[model samples]
Target chain A: MTAPHEPIPGTTIFDGRMAMKGYPLNKMCYSFNEAAARQEFLADEDAYCAKFGLTDEQKTAIKERNALALLAAGGNIYYLAKFIGMLGLNVQDIGAQQTGMTVEEFKAKLKAAGN
Target chain B: MAKIVGGVTTSHIPAIGNAIANELFEDPYWKPFFDGYPKAREWLAEVKPDVAIVVYNDHGLNFFLDKMPTFSIGAAPEYQNKDEGWGLKPLPPYPGDPELSWHIIESLVNDEFDICSCQEMAVDHGFTVPMALLWPDQTQRPVRTIPVAVNTVQHPLPTPARCLKLGEAIGRAVASYPKDLKVVVLGTGGLSHQLDGERAGFINKDFDLMCLEKIVDEPEALAKYSIHDLVRLAGAQGAELILWLIMRGALGRKVSKVHSNYHIPISNTGAGLLVLESAA
Candidate 1:
């Protein structure tokens, strides 16, 4: 019996020949991977805030508001990273942006901002 | 010998196809656009292509951002519909031409172009919406199809010119195939539409009109457009228009516009269609 879901061997999906000639696959792939990693970080708001020096209040706000939820509702986390990139911050910097004080003041500032 | 009977371009505004299939004529948004395709509908019946090389983009369904390819070709027996976040559209799967597909594959390979050959894959609305639009008659679609997937959804997508070069490669591939059949190169997606950010509703009629002009008269000129230029001028989602160049390129430099239509009832987007046949 033939096994199911087998792709024809030795086929080229994207032509690597002209890949970087006009469009650089390397830069594209790097940005995509970074975006995916940021998505994973956002999925768990609490840990993400802590790792990025967010205060308790900010962490609670992130968890409660579910900032990641905003990213999820929109298609593909890649675009969200683009938005963050536009703000001149990576996913980690997002937590810092919310909290003016160090990691200690994150939670309080988050709660204060929520008000 | 395969001659591009002509090429068709359209915005494929989701609602337009939905309105037609479900017979929702009363829909204010779609009525005008649907009415515009009467000539296009007639044209499809007249040409009756033997095999259609559908050039479109996949929205993270078959291949994700993980390892996205700039271009991917489908050589499967049949393709099912994919549910992309929102549920799948109500339609039967598409039939493909494996014989012609293999022939095109071999020819394109011999010409030194690498093509991805998929045995089992489901095509999204990018392929099906146009299918439903061009071939509304269930009894006779007149041609089988080969799905060509381009990586347009991702950030580092191929440039407009790169897409066009691939089209030339496609043209050469189709010409060399040892089949005496009529082929229709259907390049789907956009005159313009942007589905993101505060600037979500953006439309650029001048750029879109220029695209229609180039697809028929001077496709090479379009290759000079960068992804940033397309996105900035046409809106981010509007960048998908690059895929249309592939269809134009496949038809080669000698083509005449048999039919053309454009509408912008929807905000921040423009839709247009063109039919081109190889010059006699």
Candidate 2:
């Protein structure tokens, strides 16, 4: 068996432990792949999340539109991206939100990395 | 017998799809990323490979956690792209080569890499973006495809070394095929960029450039990085670089770099493009 993964300070691994914990949240986000499901979630947010049996933490994180909170609540970025997309927000906006940067600052950090 | 004409690597960022749909190729914000592709397209036009094996990861579009396959290959007659939320319009279905797909499936399993064989798969941007970048005009798409899906979405993702072996296995599969064919392997996704947690928007240029250089000559050097090492150094989603190794492995021991491009901050990611021709 492989050794336990050493934690990365600001990153979540989304391994089996996290996957099992976040299944309900991710399962709900996965439904957004369909137009009807996205529309349904938009129409009744709380009911939609409730139907998926999202944990209170997941539900709260969703309400806050917080990416880091979602991660703490067991959300995988790829799946959570679908949920973020439904909010008419792309990765940049959520990225800025997570790192506490303005969208421009977040984008600038990315640009400077290339320089 | 088949010949691997070359390999192409590019980021399959969904934002690129939006930029394409909006005809923002010349838009300053997107110009650098878009500029990288024309040379790649020129290279493709010249090679005219009959088949393209796309090595990419699914992003909640095909398999959810319910039944995630560590590795999956499309054996369907055609693969389709579906609504991935955020309303990126799905592209037309990509036709496939079932015969070739089966040949690869058998060879990989024989090589002891038991992968999931999908009769049906819904490819997301991971598959479609690279196709669009390479063959912008779908009607004129000169190449058929075999999507080799690796699991980068969840943890316990395959190691860089293992994925390289898988690619070598695929190379053997293509070489053994009886038909005369030309194949191009495409490794899609990542130079480096993290997309989740307090670390979102992370980009590592040094690591990105190192992989680009090493991928050409020292792929085993790349294989040396453990999955955790990659996540730590490359960022979470940046770990998708392993997919590129699969493309590199198929290129064999010697290759000549045809053209390469790298740009950063494309929707919170470092986008890279590389075209290599087998020299061995």
Candidate 3:
């Protein structure tokens, strides 16, 4: 069922529609829950995404390692967290990339906003 | 017959767990957030429930996207905390109440809520952080826990209405138990703040305060909120606040607000803490 509301700007809600659209990408990230799966993906990214049946858009997003792109391609942040973890990145790092700021800048913004 | 003692709702932010583990509460930056829990600790000391039903969402820890359950009940005797790849030191295993968990599972299913029964599950920060906040002394866990894991990670998360209904069913189930047990429902997660996308630092204090106020007495009104509305109004990660409804549901209709604390930007979250005692 579609949400009986207008879409919020600059935010891609990971609703059922996005979940279905990005299933392959999310499933691939889900595989990272296992250490061996993470290692396998690191060894051959294309082969791994192919196994999970990622779409061309998802494959590109994975190759790019862009959190926003993955979200656009149907990657839930929690699942995508595993994918980012594989790259030695944390949620703050992804947040920085999404907001087009450096990690230090993003953290500073967080501190300032809280104050 | 058993009675519902109360419900506790808090944002199970992972950073809060780290601060507590590292003893960084004394630090000025973290002091305010940590300060919010002493009253809760005192309250728990006063009315120690025999069983606490912890309602939280797993964040890619135990059940990944492979077979995500909409509602999973942990019936195991013990739940171990695991490292979620960020190297946060895992906490000591928490004891579980199998009997109560089974009762909840059977009752929820019979109540038409298809819940996945989990005999084995390792809890992430979503489960452990709140535990630490409630009972800081690891040696003395005040209550046996039955973890209720909900699907807020993947899409098609149970609507607010369904979550409220699930809680009500749990309340009925708890009341049906033959033992003279006291139960507390703990709902953890969200009060607005997104962790990703261009709106990463988003925090709506007004929206969150509104939620905190309404959740105490008018939770039924919250069921009208669609997930889309939740994400748009409260941040994406903040949408997990729906889990709070489950705890509120288990408390029955009338509840007394015992104590509450809300702070902004606890690492990209409007962290909230609330305690509601069953009016009965």
Candidate 4:
């Protein structure tokens, strides 16, 4: 969890504390590995959230499609990624959203890592 | 004795899977990353390892937060790649060596590292992308696989030092096996890139470059780093560099870095590939 460790700026380590908090959100996303779960979530997003028994904050984060908010709510990127992809978004899209950049700008930053 | 031939380590990102599926080898945007593979494939062809012990982390596929094991090894007859939500086309089941797997499990446990021996496990891109890259044509397969997943999904993960020792244990296990076999160790993922938090776009080419070099010779230098140090320098997801260390520890003490490729922005990752030979 959030065991008092030196902080990495802007990074949230998905530790046990976060894992416990994000369980419902993550479990819901983990289900997306199945095509049926994906369809079911898509058909009734609210009902799906209710089924997972997600916290109000987690539900709000999902509703807003906010990557940072989701992280703050203890979402693990591995599973949150499934939820993001289910909504027709990719990692780059989430990167851009979290960094407050356009997807192209985010990609440019990534490409610049080579130089 | 099964000779520990060497190691091949590469990025197992989901994006690369899409590129391979679409045959984007020549696509200008993807060429730099995809171009890094031919040498590795060539090396794989020459060595022709009979068994590949793949070191990767399960990205919420075979594992979940419900009960996370620090280290898990696959002992199933065959391993299947499944729909990990992105709907990347699942590849055919990669054959497994339950005998080798059980042997390794027994050895590692006997080596004092508790291991979860799994009879059924679903491998995600972490396990498949590298398989596809090394064996794009399927002919390169028929080489059985044993997956050793070091937990990277959760924090307080086994340290870089621990994973390398685990790999060393694996090398010892393979070496002690009664059967004579040519074994290859695969370290997949990382060269630094993060996928979550406000630091999502983080990538450190310098650190990755340092690792690509050190891992070939003095892996202990890399092992000196803690999991926190890795996440700090490599990015959260970039912490996967531990996988490479595990692969490195499994190689011979005197190692030759036969081939290596490093490219940036391979889908929010610093894609790296290395083909090593434990020289005679």
- How well does chain B match by TM-score in each candidate? 0.92, 0.98, 0.98, 0.98
Candidate 4's iRMSD: 0.9
lDDT of 2 by residue, A18-84 (tens): 8888989999999998989988988999999999999999999989888888998889898899988
- The interface root-mean-square deviations, each candidate in sequence, come to 16.2, 1.0, 2.1, 0.9
Q: How far is candidate 2 from the true structure (C-alpha RMSD, Å)?
A: 1.2
Q: Which tens-of-lDDT digit does each residue in B1-280 have in candidate 2?
A: 8989899999999888889989998899999889988999998888889999999999989998888888899999989988897776656788899999999999989889979999999899999999999999966657788998999888888989999999888889999999999999999999898888888888889999988899998899999999999989999888899999999999888999999998887987888899999974
List candidate 4 stretches off by more than 4 Å.
Answer: A1-3
Counting clashing residue pairs in each candidate, in order, gives 14, 0, 0, 2
- Tens-place lDDT per residue, model 4, B225-251, is 988999999999888988988888888
Kindly give the stretch of ten consecutive residues in candidate 1 chain B with the minimal lDDT sum.
B193-202
**Model 4: per-residue Cα lDDT at residue A10:** 90
**Residue range B247-271, candidate 1, lDDT tens digits:** 8888777887777877664323577
State residue B256's C-alpha deviation in candidate 3, in Å: 1.6
lDDT of 4 at B121: 92
User: DockQ for each candidate?
Assistant: 0.04, 0.86, 0.52, 0.87
After the best TM-score superposition of candidate 3, give how far the Cα of residue B248 lies from its true spot, in angstroms. Answer: 1.0
Query: Which residue pairs show collisions in model 2?
Result: none
- Locate the minimum summed-lDDT window of 10 residues in model 4 chain A: A1-10
True contacts kept of 4: 0.90
TM-score of each: 0.71, 0.98, 0.91, 0.98
Per-residue error for B54 in candidate 1, Å, reads 0.6
